[model samples]
Target: MDRIQEIVDFWFLPESDENYGKQREVWFKKNPDFDAEVRGKFLEDFEKAEAGELLHWSESARGSLALILLFDQFTRNMFRDSPRAFAADGKAREIARHMLSCGFYDELNTVEKQFAALPFEHSEDMDDQKLSVKLFEELGSGEALDYAQRHLEIIERFGRFPHRNEQLGRESTKEEEAFLKTPNSSF
Candidate 1:
């Protein structure tokens, strides 16, 4: 398979296999450098898109940029062993920084906008959650309200995502899992 398809598969593999999440821990433990290798590949893809070399999988620059950011964030969370993984202190700021430079937020539709705000609200900043809530409210959709409520809850408490324990390779507590199930979790 082509490289892009491989990344795409990597992005969704866990959804396809219930064992995939646990299995990934095994693979990465054997090759701790793999995460950096994957990040390099993502940077290459982003650069290629900048040079107008992207093909087949997507046609829009915005979609491509969002996908890169999404997977970048996801991989960092999933593969905590990655040397380049985002740290807790400034993770949200890093994502928001990327989003600012993305230069294509306005091009997204309402639904896409909601999904695109993941990096912001899911950040370490409580204000990012407010921004996310406002953005979702602007969409005026029921799904958005659900998201707004969830973001509010996070902002009210941790000011960051807690259900991330599983992906961060820590066992999630019962309270954490209960919190995850109660609202709109990333899972």
Candidate 2:
């Protein structure tokens, strides 16, 4: 299978209750093996994609989605807890904006649409955060909408994600520190 196809297939599993949980586990929970596999197998491709070598991938909806995943999702796992984890965020957001403008985003199913909008959701910029909330609301996933609202609230309050402070080496303000202590503050 094509490398991009492999990533798309693995990350976007068939939708179901069990698969949704599995996807959350894989994406949210830290697993050494999964991280290592992503590092070993797709790191090169990721690097290439980052260098603008994979612009051709944007020619199709699935290809564009896969490119977004490489920049937004895989980078998080491959370089967890480091600034590098967010290095590709701008690129991912750019591709997402392109997808939306070009109408490719409309082709995706609910789960894929959520991911395609994630770069916006993960952004600290209030505008992007608001767009993320709008996208999630349109997608009609209560869970995604909740998370999007939470992320937007954080950005609205702090202008950034306090949870990323340690990784990015930024000092947290007192209010942000307090917020970070509360349950489910980071996401």
**Candidate 1 segments exceeding 4 Å error:** 1-64, 67-103, 166-187
Q: Tens digit of lDDT per residue, candidate 1, span 59-159? A: 44344434544344444644454333544224334433454466545665554455456565555566776776776777677765676767678657755
TM-score of each: 0.47, 0.93
lDDT of 2 by residue, 52-150 (tens): 899999988988999999999999889998999998999999999999999999998777898999999999999999999999999888987999999
Once fitted onto the true fold, the runs of candidate 2 whose alpha carbons sit more than 4 angstroms away are: 14-24
Model 2 lowest lDDT segment of ten? 14-23
User: How does model 2 fare in lDDT?
Assistant: 0.89
TM-score, prediction 2: 0.93
Best by TM-score: 2
- Clashing pairs in model 1? none
